[model samples]
Target: MKKTILLLSVLFLLISCGKAKNKAILQGKVENEQIAIVSKIPGKIVQLLVKEGDFVKKGDTLAILDIPEVDAKKSQAEGAVISAKAQYSMAVKGATENQLKQLEAKKMGLKEQYEFAKKSINRLSNMLKDSLVSQQTFDETFAKYQGAQAQYNAVLAEIDEARKGARIEQQTMALGQQDRAYGALQEVETANKERYVIAPQDMSIETITLNLGELALPGYTLFNGYISNSTYFRFTIPESQLSSLKKGQEISVGIPNSDKKIKGKITIIKQLGAYGNIATAYPDYELQESLFELRISPLDLDEAKDLITKTTVTLSL
Candidate 1:
């Protein structure tokens, strides 16, 4: 009777161990898709409007940067635009009334000189024909007459040009300069808008990389956090157990120490190429067996939206 009792007890213990191994609980954690907010230009943070754990929507102002250089550039561009516009206007319009009057007065003086020089040359020419004056004297008078006539003709041409405004080519060049200045001013305005750091999408702030008054470089991530409504569950299992789960399979996940049960669907079943990529820190599967990642999305996002990320949850296989 004693030997029979001992045998029966060993058999019972073996059965219990087998049942325990079969009922082993599989576990995973909640995760969310993360994003990084970066600046396109370098500047110092003048004001930080959001903090860790703050929820923000798209287009919300998250911070303000103090880029003194942009302000200076805007001023310079504005001045250039003003100067270019004045030059273009001047090119389009003829010379001012006062300027035309001054040219006219100068022309009148040159005309008088020309007439006086012409009479002196005529008299010298006649005198030379009779041997009354030297050839050198007549030549000097003729040179003076030619100089006066050239001066009068140049003045008339100058007056005509002043009335006709600038040439077509000159007007076109001035207009081009004005356009270039406007383009520069627009570029500066765009940069000035960058001073306000706006959120690209709805997200929950997890970390702020820079503090107030800290300098942020171009392409530097200033905020790091998770996108809104992006929570999902990640599980790692051995290939041997992968047959039990299929893509698009619906499953129930239970939170440990809580009564909440979340309904989720398997969306991804991919083999982990490296050990580091495994979701579980300490896997219970055989070392030789290849690990696979199972990404399950919540069927009802509202239920899982408030779940703390990276928290453990149990799955029954």
Candidate 2:
């Protein structure tokens, strides 16, 4: 009976000590900075690189879209661009001098024909004056001269037209068309890259929300999720503790259910309250105020994972 009494007394003392420990009833949850993986453009999902709870690092591809259509369009545009370039080259380097010589020869022939028709018409006019050529012959000769003059004008216009538009200018226009086509093709290619979601940050991919073969598009349901490389729990201390919490102040972050721990610095300490009131003005102004937010960064973040988001433990208050 005496031994039983001693055991009961010890249990009561242990329970009393446990009740005396300080614990704040804080309503906080565990979560990393969840980054919503997004697609850059619209396309049908062709390949899913991960599933739910799959871990990934930065630059990891989450999924790829069916890009065959885009590829075909790009190819078509590319071919057109090539053809345009060839046309531009041809326009810049015009027809050879030999071809110009042929045109000049034709011009000379027309000139000779025009001169002969004019001389014939003049002779007919003189003949009519002498009553040697008939009126019908004079009229026909005049008409022939007019027709020859009109033909000469047409030929001269052709030569001028050839000189008006330069071969280089034509080539430049064709090159511009090619550049536009090439830009369009590049845009399509860029869209294709965006369809395959990649890790936007250097952190790990915490989850894959959608399954493989699922249709994913921009602004649609995302299939992948990410978080920061390092994670930390937050603590708010009274304004009185601001002086104590300086930059680079050593902090011990406790890990629950494991022997692991992270040593970090007191990276941030609010010098003023939410209303921008200084700490010295607090007691003179009001008693009802919220604690300032403090930022702490882990010195060794090798395993400072999102899993340790909520690390609630006894901190000097």
Candidate 3:
């Protein structure tokens, strides 16, 4: 009777093992979206605003860098803008008061010479008719008068030019220079702004790689963190289970050791290639020869928001 009892116990154990092997429950993990914050400009970290594990909001000031080069560039740009503006103003306005005064004085001198020549020509004409002055003398006097008139006209043109403002093309060229300088100033200012590292989105600080007074290089990661909204679930399912699953199909996700249940949608299903090695994310599961991946996004994100990455969870068929 004791031998029979032992045999019954062995048989029961074998049956339980077989049933456990045939179970279809899969193990998956919650995948959190992680990112590395990097700096575009290289400089010494002057201030660190956030500590590890601190929650940061979008557009939060993460750190400040001391970049002397950027400061110098900003000053240079400011000077260039000032110079351009002065040039533009000069182009728009005519000559100075002193220049106008000098031009008028020269015009007056020419007018006086013209008047003197005219009087001489009149006197010479009267003398020539009276035969007192030779014909050649009268002709010379007439030429002097013509020369004086030409000189006076040239001076008048000069005065007009000095009074008028700059030409349209000149003004346009100065305006272009001013615009280009302004654009450069804006560019430098933007670069200076980048020296202060700002958080791109809401996330938790995982690790701060650099400390105050440490040199930060361009494109070097300063902080490693995770975005809250990018969390998802990844699972590897056997080929036999792929037939029941499809993209955009609604499925149930359950947490072990907890009563939490979340509705997830099948966002991706990829079959492995022939002779391909299965890249299992969760090492707790025994991998099969023919495997497919099922990537699911939670429909109720708030329900699964607290789940950490790599924590095993169950997926319902």
Candidate 4:
């Protein structure tokens, strides 16, 4: 009879303590946001500036890539720009001195031929008047004179064109070519800059996925880091207790096995499905029970700075 009474007393005390603790505290985990550093351009890793466990700040150089393909493309674009500029200059300046001189010489030669043909036609007409030359012969000579005049006129037009520079349409086309080459060069340079991987924010390098001389493909993650600002506490509570919580409301959190209590703000509250897995201090919480989730951020960053991630914590509302 004495043994039975002692067992009953112990069982009741254990149940009472569990109920008291569950009503006052909620369970949560400490977590930080993970960041993956990826490259936009694929290339061999030329240099690794940070190793695992290193702390880095925003815009810090993380690594460098050796991209021979980008260099080759940049070179081609530069050459194209030079060629386009020369073409544009030629269009704007019209013909060169040597070209103009050659056209003028051709015009002079055509003029001499035209004069000779005119004299022949006159002589043929006179012969025909005396009936010494056939009418067919005079007709043929007149045709020759006309051909020479037309050729001389054409030569004069060409000389004028050489003196005047290229046409407006030609100049516009050359300018477009130059613009295209410049745009291409700019694109290559931008991509080349991307090869120098840099940290986007303050973080701790958790992992280095690629080593020196390894190929890093485009969009592939090269490093994994933890963002300090993303640290937060997540708690699972019974839905019956959710009415007491609201976003942006301040609350006190109790750290297990430590006297250092952290001040936090209620940042989120959401209901979970009956089947969702969650971490909570309440041992009676079951899959069939209705539960709510709460996310809180530390109001005092310094106090929670040393907290290890993914560790269980207790929350007081």
Off by over 4 Å in 2: 1-20, 23-33, 67-76, 96-140, 149-175, 221-224, 236-247, 269-292, 303-317
What local lDDT score does residue 90 receive in model 4, on the 0 to 100 scale? 81
- Indicate the TM-score of model 2: 0.64
TM-score of each: 0.87, 0.64, 0.73, 0.84
Structure candidate 2, residue pairs in collision: none
lDDT of 4: 0.87
Candidate 4's TM-score: 0.84
Which candidate gets the maximum lDDT versus the true structure?
1
Scored by lDDT, model 3 comes in at 0.85
Error of 1 at 258 (Å): 2.4
lDDT for each residue of candidate 3 in 5-103, tens digit (9 for 90 to 100): 999999999988865554466777788789899999889999999999998999999999999998998999999999999888877886689988988
Question: Which should have the higher TM-score, number 1 or number 3?
Answer: 1
Error of 3 at 137 (Å): 16
User: In candidate 2, where is summed lDDT lowest over 10 consecutive residues?
Assistant: 22-31
Model 1 scores worst on lDDT over the 10 consecutive residues at 18-27
Clashes counted in candidate 1 amount to 0
Query: What tens digits encode model 2's per-residue C-alpha lDDT throughout 1-317?
Result: 99999999999999767544322211212335566766655666777777666677768887777756777877887788788776665566554567667777888998999999999988888889999989998998889899989988887776655545345666678779878878887887776677677766655555555565665666765643546555654555555446656777887655556676567677666534464432221122225645665666767666566454453532332
lDDT of 1 by residue, 27-126 (tens): 7888999999999899999999999999999999999999999999999999999999989887889688999999999999999999999999999989
In candidate 4, which residue ranges exceed 4 Å CA deviation?
1-6, 132-144, 273-284
lDDT measured at residue 46 in model 4 versus the true structure, 0 to 100: 89
Top candidate (TM-score)? 1
Better of 1 and 2 by lDDT: 1
